[model samples]
Target chain A: MKTIKGIKISSGVVSGPIFNFERGKLTVPKHFIREADFDSELERFNTAIRKSKDELTQVRDLVHNHLDEDHAKIIEAQLLAVQDEEMITAVRELMVREKKNVTWAYFEVMDDYEKLLLKTFSQFFKERTADLKDIKKRVIYHLSHEKDIIQPEIIKPSIIVAEKMSPSDLMHIDHKLTLGIITRYGGVDSHAGILARAFRVPYISNINRIQEIVSYSEIILDADNETILLDITDDIKASYESRIQDFRRHRDNIISDKVANSTKDGVPYHIYLNAGFVDEVKAMDPALIQGIGLFRTEFLCIERNSIPDENVQFQAYKAVLEKMNDLPVVFRVYDFGRDKLLAMLDLEILQEDHVFDEWGGIGFLLDNPEILKAQLRAILRASAYGNTRIMLPLVMFVEEVVRTKEILETIKSELKREGLAFAENIELGAMIETSSVLEELDELAKYVDFFSIGTNDLALYLLGSGRMTDLTKNYYHPKMFRAIDKIIKAGNKAGIPVDVCGEMASDPYALIGLTAIGIRFISVSSSALAAISDEVSKIDVQQCGKLVNSILNADSAFTIYSHLKKFYHEQLE
Target chain B: MVRKEIKILNKYGLHTRPATALVTLVSKFKSDVFLEYNGVKVNAKSILGLLVLAVEPGANLIVEANGVDEQEAVDNLDRLAQQKFNLE
Candidate 1:
């Protein structure tokens, strides 16, 4: 069997038929229309237009009912294109004058319009070409009496093989039959990728020409290893199938125990799960962990055409809180900016000197106070149902914390005046991500109830490396560890609890270091919770503390990493 | 015919959604509407037509409408542009 490597977004193993689901380019077959069939041909074109409009209306209504108004607007936009008198008249003239088939005429009109739009609009507006193309394909499919190939009905469980899947396409995919998804182009942060993770579907992207390579083959997708094995032998397939079964069995056992949160040396610490979508929260068993540490609220805004109202926000937060059964849930305010632009909000992004620089966390929130206030009001309203806390991301200054508190006070008073029932003392915290925040940790900690150190950004910011782009493994240097140590120490001095809610906290090696540094609470992805808990139960906290202290003294990142590796195998492992 | 010149003011300029809003508004009136930018004119009631104008923030466009509801259409579109297409 040949193996293809791809960038894995979600982890799982499965074997299924490769459903070659490509959006095949529409080809317009030319035919000379006879004089007698002219009137009938024109009538046929009108019928096709009517059918196309009906299909779009149904799709729009379905999207509106199933998803949200914003998603429905995508189809609505296409409907408007269908109703464009200019486009209709152009197609009608082309068909009647050139004696061309309806499909050919429609395609020619759309092609000419696309060229004109390309010439008229700037490069920034060039992306709209895809939307225009989508409209063309939909109408042409109706004219040709062909089914829309994008939304195929899968009769059995199968792996979806495609060039790319849009967010709208991902929303419409039948989860039962879609065993896994492999695409030729996409990033882990793409909407389809995010949706795949949220749905717990095995997905990988950026495999070059995956659609052409494997044609109707029974493929084994080992997403955990980022490999897709084509045409496996029966013996190999049996082994792989058993391996998947073993993994599920192991996972079930780990999740079933409901183990207490304490190290072997009896050092009790809190393990919290990071969740974004409500579906991910529902998939999780609350009995397994303390509570949700980082509830990424941005997912609620991602697919919508308008800002989610306070009541909608309230329902989402309330559902999570009620599901947790009073477990303290920390709702992070919408951390917009960078690649996470809310097209609906149209909030002005603060210009950075470099295009790559991000405008995330509290900075984006503070710039749009109306959004911030709405989210605060929603979180506060939800807090009435269960235990909840508010956390601000990317806080680098003391003034940010002070200003946020001032706004929180204003919201609280407004709620009180309205006679709304909300938790009066919803604990507010700041995320210590930037080096600037680390430097002023003590001063900043005094204004907040707790500190959650987002080590992903902290490490990247400390080393001046892009978190995703920098291929060098040395980004997580001993210098970064020193920063973490200083922040934890400062939190202690200020008498505020410090927890880590980043990728570093999830790593077994980093968890040892964090525990040694006296970090009592750690948050990790929900999928990593059980595995990390197992590691935590094996460690002797006192010994880890000593080992970390020595590792921190190392001259370089390589030296520190090596020491930790040796320590893990010899003592912890 | 009623005509008015207005400047786009939203941060994102007259992008797809804002253009859709403008077209949807103009389509409600019986007046035939047209928008002119950089000496290129397009039917204002067509979303694709408006999108081709590629109006950036601070760009000026002359909107003209003719028919029974010409005045209403021009006044409404002018107000919408002033409000930044209600994008905020």
Candidate 2:
């Protein structure tokens, strides 16, 4: 067995056949067209053009249906480019004049076309070079009959092995058979890695000889271990197979175990799921989860141009509430801005005097009373269906909560006047993310119902870093844990329930810190549930608290970091 | 034949979405539509044509149309462009 070391972008252990997609263009074979067969040759070229159009349309529709219109817009423009009168004429003219094979003619013309586009002064036109190159590949693939030898039929679930890839290629990944993606070159924060995470697949990169390893029948991709085992013996295969089985068994055992929400010593956790849509709740056994800690209402605003009116937003929240039924679902209202965009809003992300008070969440909402009221009315209106809570994102002070409550009251009066039935009470909660919010939680908790530690943003603000710039390195900073400990302890003192969510909830060692701090609840992405459950089962809560105490009291960031790393190795290993 | 001139007034130039909107509007009519910007004329029905023009904000674009629906095409295209493709 040959073991290759690589940088793991996201973690999981998967074993599958390697589907090699070459980064460089596949060889476009050339042929001399005979005068006698000119009609047939031209017909074949036309067939390729037609097929390429169909493929672009198919991809466009797929992205439109699955993702959002924003993602679909680029493909929509490409679909128009596919039938551009000038581009089609250039391809046919090349074939007619050169007596060259359709694939070669198409390739030569498109290659030149891409260069022509890249040379253009307009950024809009220059950006089309990538699409032009992609279009060239699609057409050439249909023209060339060599499939099995080059790009095979991706029938089974396989790990994508590539030397390098573009974002468009990553977007075209057939997620049905998507086990994972590994490449010879890419940053963990590359667009491909981001898409891989969006596609819910493990991704790794930085390996050598990606092109040479295509002949292997099957390989094991243990991203968690940062190892890709190749040319595996039967024994190695069977052992990895059992490891997969063991993972599945543990997942099933914990999911089935009613008390999986508790530590081995019977300390209960309000284990919740962080969800974006209704389907995440529908996919799970409802009894296995406590509730959704964070349900982004931004999904309604994301697709299409206009802001969803009160009723449209109301219906979306109602679906989740009815689906979850008895369980409490915290709906974060229109956390739109900073990556979550509403084009109509025309948001200029102006910096407030406070660094953490960047545009989004309560800050953005409070500025637009109409938008805020519409969302407050919807969440409160939906509350009649089931248990619901309203949580504001990026809440730094108690006053924002006060304003939202005032608006909710005003909205409630409007609903009552309009004869709209809303529940008597819908809980108001705050996401403890901003650094300022941390200091104000004691004063803040009095105004809200419960608290959720949004560690992703909390860490970002605390460390004063952007997420794209190596958050994984900064995320482990010792200051992050102390902050969580502070949030949890403050929650305990204030007599309000605090739940940990975002990245820290799933990170094993950070989870250790969280559990040790006597946090009563935490929400994690559903995929990590089984592994997290297993990690909790192994931790002796009593000892973890003692370990965390020393780490917390440490004078230096380096001192605390070393202690946390040591704990991770000793316990999680 | 019919002709009209419109200014691209959107904060962002005729980028992806607005270019798409312009192409979609011109395509609905049976007329042959063309847009002239920066001394370059291009097929109004083709998104690539609009993109290559690189119609920046405040640029005056002359549109021409010929065929059965010429007048209607010219009017709608001019209106859409003036409306900034109804986008920000």
Candidate 3:
């Protein structure tokens, strides 16, 4: 019996069998040249290539129906791999000239093509087989048993430890019969990690060589602390009993409480959630949030090759609003720059393409003015049911706002002519993110109903920060506070309802200071709202106001942050 | 050659799904049907050509056909758009 230690991403425990699956890897083995079987070897190599292509098709068929668009791309990529010219050429050369066996030729070509994609690892299934017949038998078994066997009725569930799990693997695995996942291969931010988060399942990635540790039995997992308490001895069982009690206590507290955040002094404030995809929208329990803060309408408009029609948009918006019931839900109009938008629009490559242009662009919208109006018209039509506000992204000048408003008016009049009953006095807002918008805030806010300060864009734009890498570091930096101060002061003077929609709203300390800075409505992820609101209820906002006032007087952001941190520790108690 | 006019009726105008329906409809005809918007004529089968025209709702689009069954081609396309097929 052995125990393994790894990072715990999800919280749960179960004990089951060591069903050792073949891990994909790459290794070059020295084989003696046999002149007698040379003709047969070449034939075998050609047959293996044919077999590999067929297997790819089978896997694609199995997953195509069950997987989402993103997962389907992974299968498409694998199919592309099967037909790759370089791989095909290499296999042909080895078989026709080098006289290698079918399996050898396939492995050799995969090794050569390994470096092209980072995630597609090339690994030979090395087993201690005495003859070629044995290796072929194992290969057949692997292919035949690819259909995952799941028995949910089995009382004892097994923990699945793999190098990485594909989307199909996740779909097939019986969640009721499976305890958890421990991967030695994937990053915390990879697709698998995101899946685990979405499923609300406990998983840990980046655990090194987990297979060598536990013999698949007699090992216990503690997902809550990401620890594996091993050696199922008599004393360990006693300890497990005690830990179970503590686990139940923790679970009870989280499941029972559902509070939409209020100020420390019992003052009410709106805490809303931002949803991009339907899965995320469906996952949100509205009893936990005030309303949908910002439904990123761009996903529906920007994901596919062409924009979705008003009815498609209507179904998505109506479903979300219906789920929320009477709650006020806001939708941000499709924000597309030159790069993110599809130039050669097709259904397949639409989601695969990135928003990268020579002008440091992040979207595809410059040439597509009609697409923008199509989206705006859709949003206006959907606003007829429940309270819906239309917000624009990357509005830098007053002219853009005026033109957008004119477009809205045209759509509204068209709707009226059709005798469509729509939301009267629908509020229009702009995301204050661009430097140009900041400079023209006073004038721009006058035309819109409110302002949602997109600090993620604001910080990146001000510091000339990279959107992907510099987000976390720059967001927490003191310079970000100074920018917040400017935006808050502008919003306060303008009398427009302003809310922070960036990741910083999730921060416990930032939430406190934001309320202290005189900004009330804060939008964050639904998961963090209850926790942050609980923290807010414990702080003295008046004292935090004094601390903010002192911090604002400081010369630099560094001094201001340090002063606030120290004040939070000393005075909050 | 034959010409037929149809008003854009689907809430989604000549996009991918509707583009697909229109292509399938035109492919059945012996005559080649051409879609025209703002005086620019394009092959009804060309997805890229149709998208460039950017015909919204309530706009008048002209369909011209030239082939063995030109009249039949024009009649079929006109019926599809006017009836708002594949939309409901």
The candidate 1 chain A region of ten consecutive residues with least summed lDDT is: A344-353
- Of the candidates shown, which would achieve the greatest DockQ relative to the real structure? 1
Could you list the chain B TM-scores for each candidate? Answer: 0.96, 0.94, 0.89
Query: Per-residue alpha-carbon lDDT of model 3 for A1-573, expressed as tens digits?
Result: 345566655455544354333333222232434667666655554454455455445434433532334434344444444444445566667755676644556556554333322222211111111111212222322222333222222245556777665433454345555556777755443334434543445566556767564453655666656666545776776667666565435433332455546666766777787665565676666676677777767555322323566677877887777677768888887764432232212122222345343221112232345556667666666676677888877776778778777877887898899987678688888887777677888888789888888876677677775432324445445566666778778777888888888767766656656766776787765445556666666666677777666545656646655665676677554
Which one wins by DockQ: 1 or 3?
A: 1
Candidate 2 — which pairs collide? none
Query: For candidate 1, lDDT tens digit of each residue in A488-572?
Result: 8888888888899876776666677777768889987755677788888888877877876576787887776676777779886
lDDT of 1 at A172: 45
Q: TM-scores, in order shown? A: 0.71, 0.65, 0.55
Q: Which tens-of-lDDT digit does each residue in A1-573 have in candidate 2? A: 788888877666778898987543456667777677667777887787776676566556544643357657777777777677766677677777888866777778777666656766777667656666556655665666343122334679888888765444553445667687888766554445544543457777887868656778788888879888888888887888877666445433425644256776777766777766455466667666677888866654432223667787888889888888679888888775443441211111111112223557798778778778888888888998988888899897799999988888888898899998888878888898888888887899788878888877787788876543446555456688788878877878888888887767777766776776677687766666666767776777776777766767766667765666677688667
Error in Å for residue B23 of model 3: 19
Q: Score the docking of each candidate (DockQ).
A: 0.38, 0.33, 0.01
Ranking by lDDT: 1, 2, 3
Report how closely model 1 matches the true complex, as a DockQ value: 0.38
TM-score winner, 1 or 2: 1
Using TM-score as the measure, the top candidate is 1
